[model samples]
Target: MTTRLNPYLGFKDNAREAMTFYQTVFGGELALSTFGEFQASEDPAEKEKIMHGMLTTDSGLVLMGADTPNSMSYTPGDNYSVSLSGEDEGELRGFWEKLSGSGTVTVPLERAPWGDTFGMCTDGFGVAWLVNIAGAQQQEAQP
Candidate 1:
């Protein structure tokens, strides 16, 4: 395997639901492992909780998530955002629409100061996202 950067999200107990929703949005193959499935926890309450969930899309997107064990603290914040950027406007816009559908759009998708169509939103699960659609001129200028 080659070096790759994949986003891993931590949820209190909704990792399964959140990851499922992502599969609907991104059209990917999702694999989930429960705590009990791997004997990862002795607590019955966490037995069914997701220990790890990964969604791998045909478009080369890999997103992972897991439920936070009761022994650890989970904090959702605005310190970070997952970004999607490319020259495919239609594909990127489709993602933005679904992601911001039941959530909040912090920035409307439009022409940005940098010349790309950009927007930011928080998904229903409270994960922040940034999408940028590269402009035609910008794409042509790139080598």
Candidate 2:
């Protein structure tokens, strides 16, 4: 298989639910593994928590999520952001509607300084996202 980069989300305790929700929005296949299944957690309470979850969409979007292990620390911060960018306004806007529906829209989708329609939002799961609809200049520069 070829190498690829994808977003890996870290959740405090809702990895399974969050991943399932993403599957519904993106129309994908979701696979989940619990700490108990992997024998990776010593805490009984955390045994059933998600150790790993992956969602692969038909549009070739791969999203991974996992619950923070009992031994690890989880802090919500501006650590990372998942970015979606393309010239397909309709498709991208469709995603924005679903993703930002119940989430917080820090920046409404609109024209940006670089001329693209851009926005930033934090999903219901507290995941930050950046969506950009490429402008004329960007589309022209693409091969």
Candidate 3:
């Protein structure tokens, strides 16, 4: 396997639900492991919470996420952000809608100065995202 860069999200407590929703949106094989499965958490309440969750899409997208343990300090404003960029307008837009819904839109999706459609938002899990749709002329010019 070649080296790849992908987004790994961090959640307060809803890692499983967030990963499941992402699977529904991207259509992929989602492999998840809980704190109990790994014997990583001492708290019984956190046993079932996700320790690690990886979603590998058929489109070659890999997204990983985990629930933050209470033992550690977790602030909502920072940490992880995923950037989704490509020429697929319909697909990227669909993802933006699903990700931004019930969450906050830091930057509304719209046409950018680079001639591409772009937007930024933080998902319900507090994971930031950047979605970009390439320009039509750029596509046409590509041989």
Candidate 4:
């Protein structure tokens, strides 16, 4: 209903698995629809590929992703990483663990010189993510 900016990932053929994995880490409701669910595909193999999928977390995070149709060139890039920043250390840490479990951790989550816990990693599906836990001083309210 309102304007929102969120990550919409592109996968070669693993959109379902990747989205499901994200749901586990973010604790949310996931809705997925595939090409076959809507219309028959000329290519049998692609009929089941995801057309669109969305995950809305309890924390109000919304992430959408889909399998790149054969008609398009799905060039996976390292250009960006979905970032999560907040004062909730426990929640953010939990997400970091699950997200980096079967993936590569480019940066370990630890205290930073700027007084925050931060890390970056590429999920199993090749989607990058960054998580930051605000430090104690950051927990205070600001006018």
Candidate 1's residue-wise lDDT over 63-102, tens digit each? Answer: 8778888986567853345767667667788889999997
How good is model 1 by TM-score? Answer: 0.54
Q: In model 4, which regions exceed 4 Å deviation?
A: 78-143
When 2 and 3 are scored with lDDT, the better candidate is 3
Candidate 1 — which residues are off by over 4 angstroms?
A: 78-143
- lDDT by residue (1-143, candidate 2, tens digit) is 22334676888898889899998899889999888886766799998999768798888988877887767657876434676766777788888999899799988999765578888788999987778787874567669
State in Å the error of residue 58, model 4: 1.6
Show pairs that collide, candidate 2.
none
Which lDDT tens digits does candidate 3 get at residues 1-143?
22234776789999999999999999999999888886777999899999778898888888888898888657776757676766766777889999999699987998765567778798998777877677884557669
Residue 114's C-alpha lDDT in candidate 3? 51
Clashes of 2: 0
Q: After superposition, how far is residue 118 of candidate 1 from its true place, in Å?
A: 36
Minimal lDDT window, size 10, model 1: 1-10
